[model samples]
Target chain A: MNPANGGWLIALTLVAAMLLGVVHLPETWPGWLGWLRPNWLILVLFFWVIEVPHRVGLIAMWITGLFVDVLYADPVGLNGLILASVSYLGWRFFERLRMYSVLQQCGILFLLVLGAEVLSVMVLGLGSERPWSWHVLVSALVTMLVWPLMFLLLLRLRTGLRVE
Target chain B: MSALLITLESSTRLLDPLRSFIGSLVSPIYVVAESPYLLTNAVGDVLATREQLQQKNRDLERRVLELSQISQQYVALKAENDRLRELLGSQGRLPYEVLIAELVGVIPDPTTFQIIIDKGADAGLSVGQAVLDAEGLFGQVVEVNRFTSRVLLLTDRDHAVPVRINRNGVRSIAGGTGDMGSLVLENVAISADIVEGDRVETSGLGGRFPPGYPVGIVASVVVEPTSAFAEVLVRPSALLDRSRHVLVIFTPQPQIESNDANTDGVVDLDQGEAAPATNGVENAQAGAT
Candidate 1:
């Protein structure tokens, strides 16, 4: 496929991922399960940043973070700052990240996601007086666990569709 | 860090318009995302057995009959109450106008207990309006966008409501503990007339919430001998996690009358009317029990 079509396809996948991230689970789902939900938006952004660092840069990630901020009714620019920093790190190490094994990548992504969670907590703490809890780390771990699956799935799509 | 802090602190003015624009833009995405769950629920209803459907219909009819009977008595009581208020030189309780909205999205982060509804300022919603489910008081609107608004749930740590014990009319402040399914009432004296199983309702002291809506039930009351205050835990009356349909209460703004009798510089006429109504309720409660 042409680079233009490939870019469009990647954008489409990212949009779908974001929708999945925002969709509400059934009310009957237990509260603990909510804490375990992986950060799908971060996972998708990380994937694209690793694969096509030139295409999905800090500006795109920041804008996507703003979208998430609106979706969650959080203070705008909070997620933008978090996502932009993380994306910058991802882009800086994109080549190195691609060379690492999936397991090593998961370890590094864990720290990245953890950093995002901590930064979000700090920012939200500054903006509002919400009590911080340990459950925030749970989502980071869940995101780490889901990384390999997302990586493999996106890799297959990119190869089969001949993206870029 | 200082710049970020300033930006974060001033976001309500600087970022609200942009946020509202983004909110309007993503509203379609929210609707599309919610469609699958809605479709599944619809399919489940369509596939229910005939006997199950019949039972549900019968149950609804019985509930409707019961409510209609209670409403008849309520109308008469309201008229009597109005007459009494007129005699006492107080304005009658203003009726609430409500708009039903569907829960579009919920903040999944456990720390922030908030939900977004499908209505906004365009629909006459304003900040501080009360939100409710079928059971009781749920929360209040803290932010209003163009096409949607966010409700800060009663379970969020930042939320606090002035509540009164239903049995003795003793007042207390119920604050969210940031935990699921619980609130904490602070500063109740050890000898206070509070107990487990006591119903709590909004006291309307701050005028943000309408008075008398059920807020929660006292789950546990712990009195430590060493401590000056008792710790009271409350579980909200509304199904905070489950209800998809909610009502946004629209309280009518007091009319601005320029008549000679109103020449006195009263800033808020509603506040003046509310005080006597509150006292009358307390007296009636005292008399009833």
Candidate 2:
């Protein structure tokens, strides 16, 4: 972390990701495009958690996710739980995550996002859940596909800005 | 701490103020998120032709002319209905004031059907005020901040409206199934005169919503001989996913902010004057025939 800004650059990136995650699609856009709206906040947090585990860990991710919960008007802590559970696994596997190629990390990210979905269902309950659509896996698969580009972009931003 | 919050926030609304405050803090984020749609709508307006504008103007003027004619008769009919209600020893209908508000955003989650309106507590809005579009009932205001409120639309899985059949005056309940286009009427007996295409309107039994506004049209009725209740599907008459402007209704009757922790979202008309609105199982059995 920098001496003067104290990680404000990281804070700005997370806020930018939160804003982008929620921008609505055009009214004339097709309905199926909604399934492709990746969980932007988590993807960015995964980058920061994997890169700077000493600074950005479960608590920071949890608080950032609380803002997402507010944006979506979800119950206050559901997203916090999703972010914390997912990022904790990222922290656990960081040495190997850093060693692996981006595509392989994409595979691991898919499992983490899938695990987050399972946590969401368990917390929210299956009483009124939609019929098994397999879209959960599709959405997770899409989030995984998004990771390599997102990772490179953030890496360039960190080095270009000299954030640390 | 998050586990504690999850339990406290869901089981009881011990966390509502915290949620509302955080929701307000996030409004700036919402404005940034909505800018793209705002830009597109502005571009569409610029591209519209003068002839199209004239056509829309003519259609609005014709609509105003027709509505004025209906309202003149409505005043007379309402006065006469009040006299009859007095004769029958019943409560007279209180007048309602309507305010117009624009939709700012629709909550984008697939699992919920909620929208944000531009008006809020500063505009005299309160939780439980009924919302409507030109065509039919839309939803009710659930959370009111300084500048905006969240409306739980009629199709949210947690929403239920007390309704009546316009054809037969039979009372029933319509519960949302998390689908934007339809709601499911609960516990309809097989013999109930409700049929496909029957108009369903607010019954005004719960007193939260004003009675007689169109809620939905009966889309289908499935009566299996072995099953005890008919599966009544209602297509909401209002365009839940399309409408841009809505009307907020202020019914003159005093309201108790319905606490969802206790009631199943149906509120009492008046705590002192009306029979208990809480006993729904018996109420359904009594009203189904």
Candidate 3:
């Protein structure tokens, strides 16, 4: 077994990739072209949770989520808590996830993303004075559509990680 | 371990130096990651572009047309310039230290609509300082970091500015409508000369803002005879959607420190007696209205 792989560098790269994934959440393209926002981070997190549940688990997700909170300037710990919960849930359900096909996995991931969106809205609504709108629903839909590509890329990245 | 944990917790305040050292170490990485690009064209490129001179010719034609129109205005301006010499004279000496800052980004979240400026506390920026563009008032400084400050724009619903009608001198306050372009006039009399096109300026009523700085121009008038107040709509003159640069005006106040120190029972009694002079103008206006 090649022991030189899956070090801190790989974990840091995963974090960077996950952070880059969130930029897709805010774009509004022309007409139907706009509906393609992939929940890149969630899909990446899902793949990593299934591949190496120990290395990139709940705590890692929580810290990355906190970084995202600062980067996006949302209420501190809102995304962190949600992302950590999602990672924990994903790891707990990793056995069932391994048996599923891409389509079934996408559907499950879509539901997870939807739940996260709802939780984020709830957190923001509690902290903010502004009225909630239907825009978040669109973002949830975009996250669902982006899942397959993110899942595939993350799966490919995981193949390179030599698990001990 | 429990005793050690308690000691560690107690000494957390002393760890600030360590935290700051770590922060400085990480700050360079952040700066490199987020720094905006500045492009420079060489003189050789300009010489090469001399072949494609049509754009330059077009630009010169536009300038000539603008110059002729400006010349016509200059003659009229030169004649009336002496008549309005006092207004022009006031413009000669701007009262505050105006620092120019470029608007870097607008935070899209409606709940806290803030804009980040290129200037920070390092550029003499402080919280509550006024930000204005060429046309009118823009925002106020809220959060100042080392390299940048966040300004809460006037159109934010939480923002309110004390203003007066230039025509009637009727003092009132305007609040933002969550739309940076519009403002709502609060507590104005039913009968006021706040017509469309009437300019509004900072009244220095609260001393939070400087006097005579243009706030906005009146956009509409909604008068209801049954209501005690008129619904005045005003559009801010600042081209907020397009303006990149703004002037952060620093108005230093000496009275705040004095007010803080003078918080005593005897001071309260003295303040009560002195309140009549301060409230006299507002009370008289309220009574008349």
Candidate 4:
């Protein structure tokens, strides 16, 4: 497996995640249901950071976060900062995180997603009039629920595609 | 952390070019993502029965005729109104240049009320421009990139509109309650003449939102003798949560000469005259009843 092929695979996966993040739901869907959509980008970033710690670095995560910031119309560098921290944590504990059971990993992922959400709300809420609500927690939960599936799927892609 | 905070606080001008550049780059991702929904809708339209298509066409034709007749009368009234305004030495409201935009994406977080529209600076959209749908005032552009703009909806807790009751023209401030369907009218004295079901319209006082667009309707009025102000809940007229198409209002920059006078007049009329006049009328009506 060559580095070039693996890099392209990673890039393609990230692009797919970005598209998922921006996809619009049907107009008829209730607003409350929107909260259930997981943070697709974060899940993918976490997966890559854990599987290929040497390949996926903090700079890459931060740049992807900037793209997410632009996509979300949030203050530039907000997501970058959040993702930088999350990727740093993942990089630091990749060995242990890899050895943990899927359920334990899910617990940690839940905390990571929740922490990101709280930080985002605190930062973005400073200038805006948005009130902090419990509904944001639903997304963290949804992200946690989606983690195992994302992990397994990415694992297969890496192995099957002979991605180094 | 401090560096991040500083970046967040700075005027986005430092990052505007970069943001816009990347925004244009990723705009197609949004378009492609939205294709499935659009395709389904197109398919649905195509699969509709011939009878259903005929019925819709006939209904639309009848509506067009009815609207044209009303528009014919409105043109005459508009001329008279312009003449009266000139006679009174007051500036007429500027005609707005409106551009239609489609909702490409919505912020999924329920706590935030913002939407990304398909039009941006390329389409002459600028921050703080008022947005509306077919029903009424929707929101305002808070950020404009190259190919997209972000709108903070009327129900965002941080958004407020200067509005007046259509019935009595009593001015008040309507603030978002973080609820999609409602706005709260603030600072109205319990004794004020506002009643349930009164229509709220933009007062055009803030210079941000143009005057006279429908905002909401009073859903409930709760007056507690213990409280200084009445709690007036208003239901937004626009489908803030549903509408896919919105109009960005390009109100020409108002000239200073008449704007200052107009502001002073609004302050006087709203504070000194309109309140007392409405109070008097309400009292007289109460006596008659």
Name the candidate that leads on DockQ.
2
Comparison by DockQ, 2 against 3, better one: 2
Candidate 2 per-residue lDDT, tens place, A85-145, comes to 7678778877878899888888888887787766665665522333445667876888899
Q: lDDT for model 4, on a 0 to 1 scale?
A: 0.79
Quick one: ranking by TM-score, best first? 1, 4, 2, 3
Give the runs in model 4 whose Cα sits over 4 Å from its true position: B5-13, B255-289
Stretches of candidate 3 exceeding 4 Å from the true structure: A1-44, A160-164, B1-94, B108-112, B187-190, B223-231, B258-289
lDDT string, candidate 4, B82-179, tens digits: 99999999987667889999987776556768888899888988767789999999988876778888788888876788899999999988888888
- If both were scored by DockQ, which would come out higher, candidate 1 or candidate 2? 2
Lowest-sum lDDT 10-residue window in model 4 chain B = B279-288
The docking category that best describes candidate 4 is acceptable
Winning model by lDDT: 4
lDDT of 4 at B82: 92
True-structure RMSD for candidate 3: 9.1
Error of 1 at A21 (Å): 1.9
lDDT per residue as tens, model 4, A77-105:
78888788878998999999999999999
What is candidate 3's lDDT per residue for A1-164, written digit by digit as tens? 66645756446655565444322212223323333445556766677777666656566676666555444445545666767877888788878887888788777877887787677667655433445655556656776677677667656655655543
Error of 3 at B157 (Å): 3.6
TM-score of each: 0.89, 0.88, 0.66, 0.88
* Candidate 1: segments with Cα more than 4 A from true spot: B1-12, B256-289
- Residue-level lDDT for A152 in candidate 2: 93
